[model samples]
Target: MYWTNYHGHSNYCDGTHLLEEYIKCAISQNVKAYGFSSHAPLPFLTNWAMPYEHLVLYFKEISELKQKYAGKIQIYTGLEQDYVADFNLIHKEWIDLPQLDYIVGSVHFVDRFEDGRYWEIDNTTEVFKEGLQGIFNGDVSQAIQRYYALTREMVQEQKPPIVGHLDKIKIHNRHEHFFDESASWYQEAIEQTLQTIAQSNAIVEINTRGVYKKKSKETYPSHWIIKRMYELDIPVTINSDAHHPEEVTREFITTAQVLKDIGYKTLRVLWNDQWQDFSFDEKGMDLK
Candidate 1:
């Protein structure tokens, strides 16, 4: 059995270690294929994303690393692209020129503040509450709806190969303080978004970061959503969304078990220069 992780980060963005450090760790973990998906450069100033000035250097370094690590492990270059209404993957000039192996389209910003700052949905609990009051006037349902709406729009319009953290907006709703996942409105939003993703042919990543980070009780697009996904026959991939070297495959065993219990017999992976499904167990995938 061998493992693979496509969502990762390094010092180029808000991540801790250098890019090479993550590669070395993946090799130690026996990862067959590893992808570097640093937070993509945004038009506006943000602390987490790769700076606009470093975009050229980021690509150059990854290209060099790919060659240096060839045959030992399969390396892929990608970006966790954010989708705002005005500035998205399609509109980004530099993103179009680069030869990205894959794109993990995501929606981290819901709407802009009155002063024109993009409201970050997953940054911190305080910031989330601020946006809840400022943007939706404490109407948690509307704010959550808008977040899923942005995701649906991205899938329907831009339609990247992968969709990152499908239900990440629920990170702050840990204790059911805002709304219940079983609520009819919440399920409707998720179902509608899943329908859009199914039509777009985008793979949904079952991210484990929330679980390991203690931000949420389950993976993004939680167990219930996974059940719904199984019903819809949506393609699913497992990603750690590691920002630190040691976090490369954290919580993967438990997550795989969860998937198994959900009746998922196969997981999608980018292998042999293409995305394919392979049978898997808690140990790892049967790539052979």
Candidate 2:
């Protein structure tokens, strides 16, 4: 069995280490394939995303690492591109870069705040509350609906290879403070989004960041969502969304067990320059 993680961050963005450091860590951890998916450059200023000017160097560095580590472990270059309504990877000037192997389309911003700043959903509890109050007038349902709406729109327009953290809006819903996941509206939103993904060729990632980060009790998209995905025949992949070297395979074993219990037999992986499905267990992928 082997492991792969296509969603990761490095110093080029807000991650803690250089790309080389993560490469070395992946090699040590027996990760068969590793991809760097730092936050793509945003049109406006932000702390976590890669600067517009730094994208050139980011592409260059990942390209070099791909060659330098070839034959050891597969290296892929990607970006965690955000879907901000009309502004998305499809509209980015650097979307056509040849070095990019794949993209993980995510929605970190839902709508704008009163000050015209894009509301960030996962940054902090205070910020989330601010957005919830200011944007939706404390209506959690409307805010959650908007988040899923943006995700659906992104899937329709951008059609990225992977969808990052499908139900990440639940990150701040600890103890069901805002609303219950078992609610009818939430389930409907998720089911609708799953229907869209079922129609497209996009793969949903079983992100372990929330679980390992202690932000949530389950993986993004959650167990119920995964079951629905299986029913829809939507492809799925496992990604740690690691920001540090030590986090490369965090909670992967448990997440795999969760998938297995939920009746997932194979996971889509980028292998030999193609995305293919391979059987996996709690340990890792059975490459053979």
Model 2's number of clashes is 0
Candidate 2 stretches greater than 4 Å from native: 88-92
Which digits, one per residue and each the tens of the lDDT, describe model 2 over residues 1-288? 789999999999999999999999998987999989999988898999998889889989988988999889999999998989767544465546687889999999999987889999998899999999999999999999999999999898888899999999999887448889999999999999999999999999999999998999999989989999998999999999999999999998999999999999999999887999999998898764
lDDT (tens digit, per residue) of candidate 1 on 1-288: 888999999999999998999999998987889998888888788899998788778888988988999888888988988888777544365346556888888899999889999899988889998999998999999999999999998887667788999999888788547788899999999999888887878999999999999999999879999998988889898899999999999998999999999999999999987999999998888774
- Give candidate 2's whole-model lDDT: 0.91
Error of 2 at 274 (Å): 0.9
Model 1 ranges with Cα > 4 A deviation: 88-95
What are the candidates' C-alpha RMSDs?
1.4, 1.3
Per-candidate clash tally: 0, 0
